[model samples]
Target: MQIAIDGPAGAGKSTIAKQIAKTLNITYLDTGAMYRAITKGVIDRKIDFADQKAIAQYAASAVITFKGQRVFLDGEEVTEGIRTPEVSEHTSEVAPIPEVRKVLVQQQQRIAEGTDVIMDGRDIGSTVLPNADYKFYLDAAVSERAKRRYEELQEKGGLNGKTLTDIEADIARRDYNDSHRAVDPLVCCDDAVRIDTTHMTIPEVVACVIDHVEDGTAK
Candidate 1:
């Protein structure tokens, strides 16, 4: 079975999808990390975000791989590198380029061809896997989402020297960009079940999704 979970960033899609994949005995794919890897590449090469052609060329040629939860770019492990604020800030700019999306979508689709996979991203349900066996859109109020992200950064270390207000502003900007991008904006499919997670715990969200999977509602 193929499952697609989509939402704006920090909606707990990645966390919930990971647990669901483990419970269902399937592979979990974090498609956002793929774009972040490319963004890291762009930053490392010092390519200006305004240079669309250069960004596209770099993204198309990038070799991205995932092993369990680890992500690699080129041949180097970038699991932690891609999580930095710099890469996160620039990902919205790189991800919307048509060429970048084309290359990554092809790779993402290839990974799901013959396996039980749970994929999560801004466009998975609406674009990458429209015919997936199950589709869900996880969401939360902007304030709640920002709090989650702030706590995440705190766990990583003192909010990376930033504040809750800073993270809130960042999330708001990303939400706008993801929803208004020219290609495959972040919108839920008509058939996708919408889960408002503003007041839901991670375990509760996971249980809710597993319920759908086992009850044959997702088939």
Candidate 2:
């Protein structure tokens, strides 16, 4: 049972994926966190984003793993570290590089082989798991998505001095980058069930997806 959920940032992909995985007793893989791990690595090493070759090499050799919900990089726990605004800002740049995507996508596929996994990311349905048994494309209005992110950061105290407006701008920029990238850009697969979550609560969205999963039909 492989489930691929694709969406832009703050569309509630991670939250929804986690709940679905829990309900179905499957593993949840946050593919965005994997890219963020690499971005964090590059930033920690002070690598220049302009040097795509170096970044790609770093991504290829980076050891990223998920122990349950926590993310690890190079055998170190970086669950919170990778979620910093700095890492989020730079992940868009790192994720679009062909070489980097090649390396991470291969890793993601390997993890899903013979495993009941629910994975979410920009290109999961279209690129990483094209043949997945269940594919969903989740989306919401930019304002709604940004507001969700702002509240989440506020709760975590991870805002890093960023306001709601700043977060909104950042999300807008990310949407553009993810959609316009040259390699495996974020896209809704033709067979995927598209869910507009702008007006729905988390449980509502989760229940909608669960219905489709159990009945094998799009609601």
TM-score of each predicted structure versus truth: 0.97, 0.97
lDDT of 2 by residue, 41-150 (tens): 99999999999999999988899988999999999999999988788888888988999999999999999999999999989888998899999999999999999999
Output the worst ten-in-a-row residue range by lDDT, candidate 1.
Answer: 153-162
lDDT of prediction 2: 0.92
TM-score of 2: 0.97
Cα deviation at 146, candidate 2, in Å, is: 0.9
